[model samples]
Target chain A: MAAIAKSSFRKTKTKNAVLPYLYLLPAFLIMGVITFYPLIYQVIISFTNFETTHLLLGLKSPDLRFIGLQNYIDIFTAALPVENFNFFRVLEFNFWWALSNVILHVPAGVLIATLLNAEGLWFKRIYRAVYILPVVVPPLVVATVWTNIFDERYGAMNQLLTNISAAFLGNADPIYIRWFEDVKPPIPGFLPGAPLTLAYYAMMVANFWLGWPFMSVVATGALQSIPKDLYEAASIDGATPVQQFWGITVPLLRPAMIPAAVYGFTLSFNLFNFVFFMSGGGPARSTELLVTFAYNLVRNLRWYGVAAAFAVIIFGVALIVFLITNRITRATQNYMEA
Target chain B: MAVNPQSTKNMFVRIMNINTSGQTAGRSLPLWKQLVFQLIALIILASVMFPIMYIVTLSFSSITTRPSKLELFPKEISFVAYRQVLDRPTGNPVTFIELLRNSFMLSMGVGAAALVIAVTAAYAFSRFKFKMREVLMILVFIPLLMPAVGLSTPLYLLLNQVQVKECKSGETAILPFTECSDGGKGKLQFNLRDSLLGVGIAMTASALPFAVWNLKGYLDTIPRELEEAAAIDGADANQTFWQIVIPLAVPQLAVTFFLGFIGHWQEFVLTWLFLSQPKDYTLAMTLYNMTGQYANSIPWNRFAAMAVIVALPVAIVYIGLQKQIVGGLTTGGVKG
Candidate 1:
């Protein structure tokens, strides 16, 4: 009788163990329906000539002709027409913008966090709250405010620059720069009387301003968590502040830094609203990133299949970065342990 | 050793020296240096506040003035923009009131649904050890990493097929039901694209991962002993979860609900993609439409008014929930 009861009890326990997975089933099902289905559907659509009109008409199949790698090749090698935008230029701009974001974001985050973490810093809470204000604001509002700041005719930036220039040049009237109006010629002297442009550069400045605050907040939080004793011990050993920062702060902050860098990299790549609202990726297609480019392809041109292809490419790139960062961080942590 | 009357005084002096030495070693720099550092910090703080201050000023400025000439203090304070936004149209106009109603209803629906689903699932994940627990956790992280823009096209395609069912005379029909005819009149059709349900579902999907992640963190921090004690007192798992775990998790639930609510309330891209019809537009989309197609017309004052109206409630809620927001992040960030 005892043996029988024990075996029955074990059976009940085994059944109970499966209950949590049952609870997880609904969420998994929803994710599968929403995320995984679309991912697979997109791959299938990429080979087809799906366009917006066809989508509206509910025409089941679009001649699924296998244009092997033609879309990808066209994206990378396309030329810009005088009146039309080029996909390749957009891709190139995306690469440059993502690289610049990493360059600015990581260093700026570390610098601000370090300043805040300085010894005898007064009213630390006030400064921290102020720094985090931008992160809480809506993206559209941020873009709007930046548009005002970057306005050519009546912007604060231009006004300030003009004043400083007037002071230095000893002139009553200052030369006004039309920041976003100029356009670069295709080739040097090939197109006569063409204007060279810095419109894309101006847009990048706005994006950097919006992105840097979140990076700083994340970095500051991580910096504060680093034990003060570690810095004190290094300083006591006759090390300068810079040496202590490099030796103790940077090494210990790597865990936090890795995550923030990955986030920054992904954000720069996927940033759409700011670019879409502020620059429209123009003066030409010089400021378009992958997200904006894909959006424009779908919304403007209605090339559904090609847009899906771009989306797939973006997903792959983001996945690769995420995986690489994860691997590097894990290895670093293991090395530290050893 | 020879005992001396003055030895006790010397011992007390030695103790005081040790205490003072340690205190001095750890004491931060002098007040003057601290003040200088603070002044530099104050300047940085001012720079951070500048853009927000400019927007607030512009919101109160006259609608007729150019965006560039707008001052920190409006020369003439006027509520023309606000009045225009609030005033009902002379002849059955679809005003900001309707837009707000739509947004509030949609946000609240999505938030409530997400909370119900996430809370139960979070409890299960936190309380039990299961075969696929780790896999489920990792799967939840995928949505966080994937950009919403990437999913827009695919979601559009899938949602296009979803249709409402109708039952009449014991025969189920999907509306607006259509049948192909050769050289004849075809059936009428209805589109789900402009419906609130479509936008709500999308919002819920986007908000789900964050809600689940946060709730799971809170659930983990709840001591298992409480549940076990309840069980010993003859309470079932359902009863224990409802009576004990639910109450304990209220603060976290509130935080997730607000975050999800605000996000959906201000969402643009998905709504823009799905709801192309003008009449179905949300408040944020309506504000966006006021600006030109390329957003170049610069409706400076009117745009600022809309922004202020939208931001006011959010800022108030944020300040009120400041402690919970910080506490939630402190726990969730470290754990996740």
Candidate 2:
């Protein structure tokens, strides 16, 4: 019996050693084709001055000479010609937009989830589903819907705003705000300050509407997973509802919060559909994101090498953000678990 | 530890009396408060559905009326805009039949392919404990983070090279050959740009990450004991997976499949990016085209009509599959 058991154990060990690799074969192959190959190919193309004309003429030969780091240098410091649009300006907007997305997404999600999780909240599922409706809707459809809503003349939003102003301020002279128009107007109630362009702000509103639901859903899930006993104990110890939330809920929910926050930030950085469909990086390129800017360079303007450099920059930023957040969260996890 | 019977009866009566009085006091709260909450909820719901309602109403309204005046209900009903969008002439005049065929075929192909690849990959990730397993798991998310813009140039170049080869051999090129085949005329002989296959592949690549991640989460929740029990009963690993695991995961499989289908059905970026020719546009792309440049050239009524037609099928599918979607989310949420 002992001899037979030993033989079975040896057989199992051998099977286990081979099984993992065998199972991983298909995943690795798919990843290689879909992800790694394109990645390597993109890095290679960044070295060359490949463009639409070159591609069309079958000039993408291996014999093309490499220009070392010129593309990267040009991307950072290169100024646009008088006839051409500035590329760095687009990158700057993308950075600000992504930062703002994190600011809005995380808190909005937390607040909504907390409200829903409160005791005596009725019709929870209905509200949750209603909130998440935008997420299920296709990005194109969302963009199309908002385009009409923000229309200068026929838009529902403008009409509603006009009505409200008329009722409250008695000024109803068919007020129409071109949400995406780049023209600046004087600030109301701010000491006659210079007017600011709202093109980027309008796009951000549409994006915020599209993105907030995802954060809320994630936060709600995280909130539900917390143990009820902890809240009960807090209540017994004479903790106020607000105090319990800050002390127990926030700290306990961090594990889920960190990941959701990182996702929101990364998603904002790579946001393409919202900017593309709503603003089209229009009104003097005020709303162009890094991704959209890169796309315009390659697909529209035929500047392949420059676009590749921009892509590399975007990737680098994303990786740095991801790593820093990952390290912080992992450390927090260790602390909590310990 | 034994209690006195008389004391127990008295305690129960006291509890009942307290509960009845508390219920009465709760009932004394103003009915207006409940009405106020309901009113607030209704307003929120309306806000959520307002855009869709606007599109629906405008779709049925007359073109003579300005779009700004369009309300929740059409003043007069007409299908003129729908007819126009359906019969609108392209340079090459693509028919409604062709558009539907392209969109349906792309969605189905991509959905099917994604299901197969994601299921296998997810199963492997969930069941196996291997070296670099965690690293491989993270690798699955790379495509999600890597925006499509970054991949477009290389893909275009690669496809262009392949097209050149086909043109040189005097065979019908499989891709949109921008230069070699058309003698630099910028016209493709056999444009893969508008082909269902190309669109499907791009959609599949984009949707794979989410599908894999979701499926892996589902597979993890299933107990290992079931598989071990099957093995004890002389079942092979494959048999166990097919008979036991797959059967139990049917609901999840359905949800994933529907999500992939809907996602591909409404996909615009990839379809627009790959298929540049007007003749090869999908339904979403077609709807976008109806709005025209500067977004005002096309009459608002006609644009709304086109949007309605485009969104109707998706809305129906969403409502039909609403239960599955909600169930999947709730289950996945709690489990994760």
Candidate 3:
């Protein structure tokens, strides 16, 4: 009787252990087939000369040859005969783009949030509601809209510029600035080969409109969580409002702001849609990012092997960036860890 | 002092006036500061609204091939663009209505499918602990770090391999099935490359990871007491999950669905990469194609009309759920 009872208890334990696995099966299957498999598949195909010939039969094609890191070597050595291509230049631009955006966005966000949180500020809700408009509009739409706005002939931007010039200099000759097509870098020698072109500045303005509202929103959320009594106490201790903002508020908001800034950096780094749709890496590939260049290899050139290797390189770069940011900010960590 | 009652009343009035003035002085911006703040606010608002306002106004403007001046507002407002949007000037096979239906169906399907799979998985992650739990959780989030555009090439290849062709002639078919004799004389191939459903599946690969992470975060916050109570009353795991947990997760489900739907609706990459057939074109693809070689050739007003139309649903959903969307965004900073 004792032996039988022990066996039955073991049976129940086994059944209980199986339940979680059963629950996880569906999610793992979907993710494994669609996401994980493709990721691994990409890695495998990157080593081989995979292109249109092998697309039909895939790995089964005997014609599929293993090239053994030739793709990687080609990309790094700049051996590929593609126009307007340089790996290092694109990487530098991508980093600078993300960094510049964060530098602008985070402070602007905190300042705006502080202003909105000011005593007796009217229409706070309206300001927030309207500000979030840019955040909701898809990046593709934003890109197109901004492109149209920057159109040389009928674009609102040039027209506005022309009007301002007309008022000041007495020349209304419809100032048609080649916003997208201008390859000349306004500020030269700052970045290696990747000059900050007029198109770059135009993109910055467009992305600034797209990017800042999100940081402000995050900052606003963080600001609200700070207790009101702290401000009162600061005031009681004879701290000026500006002093209180710096001494108390900024420190307290750091926990939220750091992570937000990191996230913002990552976002602007891999901002594919806005860059792709707006510029198409135009005017001599001056504005091309790593992701966009990788995509161009596939889309325009149909160099599958080279594109795959480029993608893998992008992944490695992204991972390194993520790790560095995580170390600095601990963005992914729980609050308890901090 | 007792004799002078009028002086006592005057003192009381003076004290009340001092209190009112002091209260007003505590929390008001100075006149110049106020002016500066208002000016800055209005300028930013105008700049932010410029493109949107341009499109909104342009949709109402008359269709102009060449405009000598950049007009902020139309001299004559007309609905010619809207009518043209409905009419087929471009010789595309799919009509506007058909494209709308396909887009709507595809987005909704992806939303529902992602939610269904994701909820169960999120519930597991939230409630149950299994072997390799940490490892699996990392796997779920791994896709979030990688650039989505990177995966398109491989997914295009993988999706093409499973192309099931109906063997009618058997000569053209890659894999000829000898069993089916009742089918049409000409061969039929159901390649995943050309279908919208296939595109949704590809989209779900990206959407699933995000949904799982977000929903899991939400589910983690939900107290387990309800489930414990249900279990104490002799309810099974499935019963507890279905009756208690799912109903509680409704708001999150809605958020997940709409977020996924909005993204899939605007998805251009996979559709552009995979779908060659014009019949499978989404609004995004059509809009992209409209920006073809001749920017001048494309009707400005009609394009603006399409832009407004595409933006409308997303805008409505966003406005309606601003609070929740904001909440989701900050927490799930992982992009959809």
Candidate 4:
């Protein structure tokens, strides 16, 4: 009986030890092959002068030589002979794009959410559902639609502008604003590569349309969590609506909003689909972001080594950004904080 | 338990006061202020809907001439562009139906794989305490944080090198191959590039992280009591999990799957990178290919129709799953 009990206990212990690992196996295996392997592979490839010639042979090829940090140096120093390939410019534009998007989106989102959160607001649900159109429509479609809307002769945007100019300026020759093709920066010397151009504004308009609804949805959720009694109490105390809004609502919404803002910033930072499909990082690549430029290096230029190195840099930048934001917002600090 | 008429009356009066207070506050806002707010909202809505409206109108119009002016309301509607989209008699060999089929297959395969992989992993994270769990959880989420395109280079290369072993029988190669063709024996290697299966696998990598994160948060909320009860009833852990937790997790799993499906349906960048064959062209890739270096190569009307076609499934899925999506997004933030 003692031996039997001991054997059963040992069996259960072994099972217990193995159960979680069993559950985790499938996911870890898939992620290992696809995610982890590629990341490690990218790091290795980044260190080598891997190109199209080494494509067929892969790593086992004798001609595939390891060149340390040269790819990174070429990218940063603008030594690559690709057209308008400057790293700092792309980096600067990426930062500016994300920052400006957040700046525009957060306030608009809050205001809209607050309005929609009104006590007697009619069709609020309808408004929210309609606004969610942008969120549902993929970036590729959104970019394509917006691109056509901004077309020089055939676009509605220029037509709208033309009508406005006709109404106001009495000039009806059609104000054909070259939205995507204009290389000249609307604001010179603002970004490192003088990155803020008319195309940037066009993107701002298009992305603002795409971005704000998400923020509003997030803000709306946060707003709903705020107790109704807080407003009633403030009102009972003879506080103005503005006062109550600023004092009660703003402070209450911060914890949620800060993390959301960080998320929004991160998303826009690496918004490859929109920037790629919409602008193609054109107008002399002034609007090219780090990710898009890296993609272009592969797709158009086929500079595999440099592109891999660029990807590594992007990964590093993403990690740093995530860490900084996480530190600031404590977004991932649940365990530590607790 | 004492019935107090006085207390009840006081509560009634307080409720009345609250209602009146709300009413008065609503009335106190100047008429112009409300009007201005509504006006701004309408204008914003108009602007938001402008591109959509343009696309819709353009899709309805004839392709004889591109409209010179803004035509929000179509004067004469035609289905010519839709016909063109449906029957591609021109540049690409792949038809619209084929594109739809490819997109559907790739996205569905990706969605199912992501769901299956994420569900088990999420269950483990939510239910168990183990070594390296936190580290592994962080590892799972790390991919979500980085731009997916950043890793596309290595995947592009890796997928390019994947070779399925083909066995040689007689003079012909028998393709139910069991071994690696790397040894230069009586075997041939078939590279998996430009294949739907390869693209689907690549897409699953991008979709898995969020699926795991969202599902884990949801599973965390499901009470452990049921599983515990099942354990008490002599059911093993696996039995308890399969019977109780999976059924409970179905709704969330559906939500995750739909979200992924909608995303993968419209994914083009990876498809563009991995696939060179026209047969594997997704609807998104096909739509993207409509535009050329010069703007007028593809007619505007046909492009609009194609955009509509590409966006339709996504729109339907989103509208159908709006509540779940909104719920998921809001909750997903703090936890994710």
Best lDDT among the predictions, by candidate number: 4
Please give the CA lDDT of all the candidate structures.
0.66, 0.67, 0.78, 0.79
Q: Model 3 chain B — which ten-residue stretch has the worst lDDT?
A: B14-23
lDDT tens per residue, model 4, A108-181 = 89888887666654444456656767877877799878877887788889999988899999998888889889
Encode model 2's per-residue lDDT on A1-338: one tens digit a residue.
99999999899778877776775676567667756666677787788776665665334455465777877777766552323245566666666788788888788778766765554445655666677666666667777777777777888778777877888999967778888774553344321222224766776677777777667766766676777778888978999879998998898777666666666666677777677777777766656677777777766777776677777777776667667766766776687798
Q: Residue A323 in candidate 1 has what lDDT?
A: 79
How far out, in Å, is residue B46 in model 4? Answer: 1.3
Q: What TM-score would each prediction reach against the true structure? A: 0.81, 0.80, 0.90, 0.90
Q: Could you tell which candidate, 2 or 4, scores higher by DockQ?
A: 4
In candidate 3, list every pair of residues with a backbone clash.
Answer: none
Ranking of predictions according to DockQ: 4, 3, 2, 1
Error (Å) of candidate 1 at residue A121 is 4.6
Given candidate 2, what's the lDDT at residue A64? 61
Q: What lDDT would candidate 1 get against the real structure?
A: 0.66
Q: 1 or 4, which is superior by DockQ? A: 4
Per-residue lDDT tens digits for candidate 3, residues B1-336, read 002223344443321111112233345777777777777777778888878877877888876574455566666679998778877624586788877887888888989888998888898889987788898888898887778788877777788765565655554444323324445434447778678877888888888888899899999999999999998897878898899999999998999899888888887777888888888788877777655234577788877878777777787776665557666765576432
Ranking of candidates on lDDT, top first: 4, 3, 2, 1
